[model samples]
Target: MTQKTMSSLQRVLTSLSHKEPDRVPFFLLTTMHGAKELGISIEQYFSQARNVVEGQLRMREKYRHDCYYSFFYAPIEVEAWGGEVLFYDDGPPNSGAPIIRNAENIKHLTPPKIEETPCLLKVLEATRLLKNEVGDDAPIIGVAMSPYSLPVMQMGFDNYIELMLDQPDLFAQLMKVNEAFCIAWSNAQLEAGATAICYFDPVSSTTITPREMYLKTGFNVARQTLAQIKGPTATHMASGRCLPIVEDLANTGTAIIGVSVLEDLAELKSACRGKLTVLGNLNGIEMRRWTLEQAESKVKDAIARAGSGGGFILSDNHGEIPWQVSDEILMAISEAVHKWGKYPLTWLEDHG
Candidate 1:
């Protein structure tokens, strides 16, 4: 039988379906890196829809990555909900202050309509442009912070942690509002042209929220939100100690789960095998600091660990690809994946 050659979309979708494509797909959690490559300040890159589209296009063209993710920062929804954001010329935006300081404020809070919010509207606009320009050539993912992180953004992380224990009922109510907002924002992006929603939930890890609390609030809300989305959905768990909740994350029914280098890729692959595509485990910080030889070694190691059978994507473990990562490093990662990541169980036996 003749094997099929897959486009970027087909390759990603194929892997998401827990099957192999011609080669392993590459995903970058890019933000500032794209702006840097475009020779523009991060502020300029995210200031308008056109700049966002151009930056993403240039980055995708340069990397020729299998997936292009449209993400500005984690605080888009928070900014929409009246939180302040500190924009930097050289880096991605950062959340400035908490909008909801106490649990009592939760009752008065309301979800922002995506169309009425400036930053979110820009994101949707960029998604539309990318879809029109790229057509069906590659998969364009629209990103939003998951319910776990949303509450953290609204109230500061420290306050949120306290609420999880002191005011569980209030936290649960806030999560419901955040979940509704995430669903609306994600659906708008999907309607605008994103093929999938990559929901980022870094605060749900055992390191921050207790496993039991997360399962009750974060996990439940994530499952509900994923169910409402029409297209494929991916959950990006950015915390280091994410191993404990791997099964809970998979239970949310996301088509893909973004694993960080902090977790054991082999263990995650074992847990998620034939269930959902696992996309990651590369340390973005280490990748940025390593030489070409070092980077290639790590890339090959990741492939050897998780790039078996099908259902694995080569990617950076963190949320945003750091600006320190040069184009050479990024390209080296792609080259190494193409060279070492091939289907079938023969290579593992040879190396092992």
Candidate 2:
């Protein structure tokens, strides 16, 4: 079977349901490298609706990624609340300063209105364009940050973590406020045609002090925000330090769990134990240095091990598919999936 005979929506659901399809599905959170390689500046691409649509079309035609990401993040929403962002020429923007640095400042803080933000509106327009162009060709996904990431991006991570120590109540209150932002922004993207949303929180990993992550972050409020999204959701942490929190992450009720470089597919598969969909394991750092054929072989082997069950999807631990792989390498990955991914056991034999 070929893509001409199937729709992107069908492919997603089919994979989620644990059934073998003509080819494995592709999903991405966001890709800065893809944007840069395509020669579209972030400002120019994000400024107009057509630029956003064309960028996605080029990626779809080139890599055949099954899902299209809006390339927006939660901090952009904070910008609406009057926070400042430092934009870069080649990657996602960074926050300039914390909007609320002290527990005492919490009393004066007011959440930003989603409809009024400039950067956020750009994403809304992109979502609308995605719906119009590839509406049924591929599912579109939007992103939001978890409480751990939201506060730190709005207020410096160190400052916010200190507040957590001096006053636990303040930490809880801040998260409560941030949760509202998540709901509003996620709802807006859903309305604009997002079939799913991703909540990323790499800051609360095990590498940080427990007082900062586990107690001050991670578990409790994350549950609340994940519960509010109307569409399917995935919890993404692109850091190796967070592997210890896997069980706690499993409790979030999200549809998928996206792990990072620290964990391997075999480990993730064992940890998830069929409780959640596991979607990663290709090592971005290692592949960046390998030949295209070597990279494709690595991805294929990962699929054979981690993708054996119905719940796994293939992807790199972090970053976009590096341009070094070229069209030929990417096609090799697709071809391998088509050849070896089907179920009903094509080659296995019984010893009886």
Over 278-299, each residue of candidate 2 has an lDDT whose tens digit, in order, gives 7776666565466756755676
Clashing residue pairs in all predictions, respectively, total 0, 1
Best by lDDT: 1
CA lDDT, candidate 2, residue 91: 56
Model 1, global lDDT:
0.81
Instruction: List the candidates' TM-scores in order.
Output: 0.95, 0.85
**RMSD after CA superposition, every candidate:** 1.7, 3.6
Rate residue 177 of model 2 by lDDT. Answer: 77
lDDT of 1 by residue, 198-230 (tens): 988878767667888787777888899999988
Which has the greatest TM-score? 1
